[model samples]
Target: MSSDRTLLMRPSPAARESLSALTPILHRVVERIGETNDITTLALEPLEPPSMNFRCGQFNMLSALGVGEIAISMSSAPHERMLRHSIRDVGAVSHALCQSSVGDLVGVRGPFGSDWRVESARGDVDQRDTVVVAGGIGLAPLRGAVEELVRDTQRGGGRIFILVGAREPSQIVFRADLESWKARGAKVSLTVDLATSEWDGRVGLVTTLLADAGFDATNSRAMLCGPEVMMRFTARALIDLGMDPEGILVSLERNMQCGVGWCGHCQLGPLLLCRDGPVVPYAGLVSQLLTQRER
Candidate 1:
């Protein structure tokens, strides 16, 4: 394949081993908060937190010793010493990681991939609005960006609009955080794919919520994460609403065996989701890559 087709140049074997990508560092689990039957939020204290600086949408290769390793996104705000991972029990490695108890040591190998551009979203809020759209577990990667925006809003910055959707009300993650943001001046809306009789909230596709999200599309920058199909439609909706394609960002999910570009598992056209991005401008992506299976 053409070198231009890859996100970055592949490092030599020696370089790969010497880099942090292959060297696993031991981190102790400080807490494990369960979100649902299959999802757990884990907080880990690494041996050296400062050395592990990461931005939103980045991932870590977490290894449960004998079980195996998996690529999981960091769910905490930037610069936090206590790194967090919101994981779902979908496979052996994930199940093992979620089952880990407090004080247990797990191998961590990254703070990998590109960022969600929280800083840019915070800049010139008077001229533009930051719109965040997340669905189901997609909220995991978005949690940090939301926190960043919340902090900015608290500092007298502009308001943000967050739209979240889940299969049902029960599947919604970070309910408390969402409410807290809303109370602090963030425009937050919720919807569910299938609503129970008890649910008085909006019930339908997430796109339906856009009709009333009240964001200025021409002056808005959107960050999105969710099921591929959902993101596809969401991007289309955003475009139809007059947002620039370059201003719409999406985080992609892929089979990332290596948290670096060594493995081709996470390649998405001219980019590697591991290195070039898990978060990318919607304008740069091709349809085939975005529709592939989730991580």
Candidate 2:
């Protein structure tokens, strides 16, 4: 079997092309949707038609011209024509992105990294269950996968369950999408660490919702995106509930400068997160996830 390091070092040909080109493709922000007080979703249209189509879990390096660039995951589905990124005003570049107007031009570098591979999770049977867990803004990365999963479930595929956690009700990002997913037949549950007077749902850690989530652990695949601590505990919780560690996946974040393996900034243990993953199986990350300090 190839080691994780070896596997990560060998990126797909498309990724190699993206990494080789340092030039940014200019894209215009066609629309902006405010999700919360500090988070906004930008829909970008390339000046020319894009040459590549991004997959779920892939990230793009979005540049705010003079400000800087940041790696943001695509919140739009793979089939969409416009590239959508949900940005939070946590840093200078992100703040710039959040404040962008409908006609603003942004530089885009890639649709890089390993993907969630949601299509394969159901195998040939197409009846396997899928569970998605997102915390805070982490939902931005997993939104594409959830969208695909929802469509799959509608076509005689397995059941879909979405579990979300936020700091408060107002902190939740895809509010309307959550309602649409539930309306479309997904079993959706939400919880927050704190509650406002307007909130009437569950208030606790997202992990608590797992107990009541209905899924056959023997034939289920779980994907999680959140703070590292939250992912660590949630992955462990899923395992304790009889899910295989190998069947669980997590998306990680790091100080990524270059959106390729050439720069060593995003290394996590033996993996260069930019090339190897933002999304990876829990089985391959057990050692690193358990021992590595948060970056």
Candidate 3:
């Protein structure tokens, strides 16, 4: 679909205004999925009915009253309404999310962007092989994608290889959850740049570890999210490994001030980063990215 036509799918004005209000939801921190290098995972209970539903790989704009707001992906899938966030404590607002008490207040404003193609994968059988590659905080968004394929009762042909990496062993998000998934027979592989005494897993850049993991990619769908550099590199790897540009889906992050596209900070070429996408197919936006900055 064309870019302008794509933005037409965005929510109406009244909905956007309500999102701007930053409705408070008194959700509790039910579980800490993982915490490393100052990033924390929080689980919340909804105080009111959410106006929007989130899918795996979608995100929300969260804020702290006196501090600021940042874009965070929905760690929880639509079926699992339990809101989860993996916040890196690099700034004041993120730090607040880290230090917040179990029964704290959080301003939840989305369920935004395109969701992982779970329902489609559930119905599609043989071509259902999916691979999810993540780096840094990128693992958070794609977690739901993994959950869907692994937990989908109807999807038998679906197989997932979750390859995740971080700066070091201590900074890896969802460590315990990933471990549990692996224990439950989910095909998950983890890596880190800096090895630690406690670490017995692979040690290398995320892309390097891909050398050890192999998959039949003839008709597979691959989803990746993480730092822009990592996503670019991984996209190339998937292409080299036989995945088509159309089959490779990526989540694109830009400086977003408004959930609606009216704010121009998140613009990527003719596309609105806020409305048209946080997710873009390689076939559509590859050339635009190639013409720009290296990082």
Return the top candidate by TM-score.
Answer: 2
Who is ahead in lDDT, 1 or 2? 2
Worst 10 residues of 3 by lDDT: 1-10
TM-score per candidate, chains pooled:
0.88, 0.90, 0.84
- The residue pairs that clash in candidate 2, if any, are none
Question: Which pairs of residues clash in candidate 3, taking residues 3 or more apart in a chain or in different chains?
Answer: 27-45, 28-45
Candidate 2 residue-wise lDDT, 1-295, digit = tens: 1355334333455565554346666678999999999999999987655444888999999888779989999999987767899999999999999999998878788878988887774454257798899999999999998888888887777898999999999999898999999999999999999999999999999999998898887788899998888899888888888888888888888988888799899988888999989888898555365558756
What residue pairs clash in candidate 1, if any at all?
A: none
lDDT of 3 by residue, 1-295 (tens): 2545334323354555454434433344666644675778888765444434566777788865446777888876667757788788877888877777776656666756766666674455444677788897888888777777677524565667788988887777777779866765567888888998989988888888666676777667788888877878887887888888888888888777776667788777787766767777777566357346522
Ranking by TM-score: 2, 1, 3
Q: How do the residues 88-192 of candidate 1 rate in per-residue lDDT, one tens digit apiece? A: 999999999999999887778887888888776445423368889999999999999888888877666566999999999889999888998898788999999
Q: Evaluate residue 208 in candidate 1 and report its C-alpha lDDT on the 0 to 100 scale.
A: 89
In order, the Cα lDDT scores of the candidates are: 0.83, 0.85, 0.71
Question: In model 2, where is the ten-residue run with the lowest total lDDT?
Answer: 1-10
Better of 1 and 2 by TM-score: 2
With candidate 2 superimposed using the best TM-score fit, by how many Å does residue 125's alpha carbon deviate from the native?
Answer: 7.3
